[model samples]
Target: MAAKTWASATRDGGQSITTTSVWSVVRRLIGYECFETDPEYLLLQSIYEDLRLYFNFFQPVLKLIAKEHMDKKVIKRYDGRAIGDHDTAAPPYQQVMAFKDVPFETKARLTNLYVQLNPAHLRTTIDAKVAKLWKISW
Candidate 1:
């Protein structure tokens, strides 16, 4: 999952402000607009996507671990669009959309993963992944 991106020191030299990602903003939007639960579909989608991206960032290490724990095919299916059930009629795949548009609980477990990751590690790790994913250099 995307980590809080911006941070600042307070007047007392303590950590002050922190900012998340555009993706996180989008997740919150999903909560207010699409899913009403605490951990929305978009959030879970972000987490799933980040997991793949970060695995690639630390290739040979985390990649192997992710491969061992998560099936390639299954992880590929974490496209956020498959949150709930499948409905292929309404918006092409109405069944899938309907399934994906359910309560946030369907995607809440991912939130636990996000909360568990250390903020410091998450930020550095995600930054590395994002940079690599975008093919940029230091």
Candidate 2:
């Protein structure tokens, strides 16, 4: 018999299920920059995966610069109208830190990492790696 996967073994009626939103964003981020060519693609899947890791490493830095709107609360009016109360636009890192359930140690670690990142350096590295990948594909 095949091994039962977590999704198949769960009984929560898909309430605990996750979506592909993260990957969809990643694909959109890299689609135009990395995969817009009509020529042959990367020779191996591992190469593409490795390149993705490089992109992921610097993604948080980009997010720090581009603040996103986050809905913190919802209010229902007497007239049955609903309104969303959003937190001031903030980076994903800041939003994560605000969550009550996140451990203090985790927050401290993330803060340490965030402070050390150099966006200019990361961008240069990403551009260099992408150019190398393009050279390989051609």
Q: Give the Cα-based TM-score of candidate 2 against the true structure.
A: 0.45
Tens-place lDDT per residue, model 1, 1-78, is 434322345345343222344444333322323222324333444544654433323222211112223554443122
Which stretches of model 2 miss by more than 4 angstroms? 1-21, 32-87
- Shift in Å, residue 61, candidate 2: 12
Q: What is the TM-score of each predicted model, taking all chains together?
A: 0.21, 0.45
In model 1, what lDDT does residue 132 have?
A: 46
Q: What's the distance in Å from true for residue 22, model 2? A: 3.6
- Clashing pairs for model 2 are none
Segments in model 1 whose C-alpha atoms lie over 4 Å from true places: 1-48, 51-115, 136-138
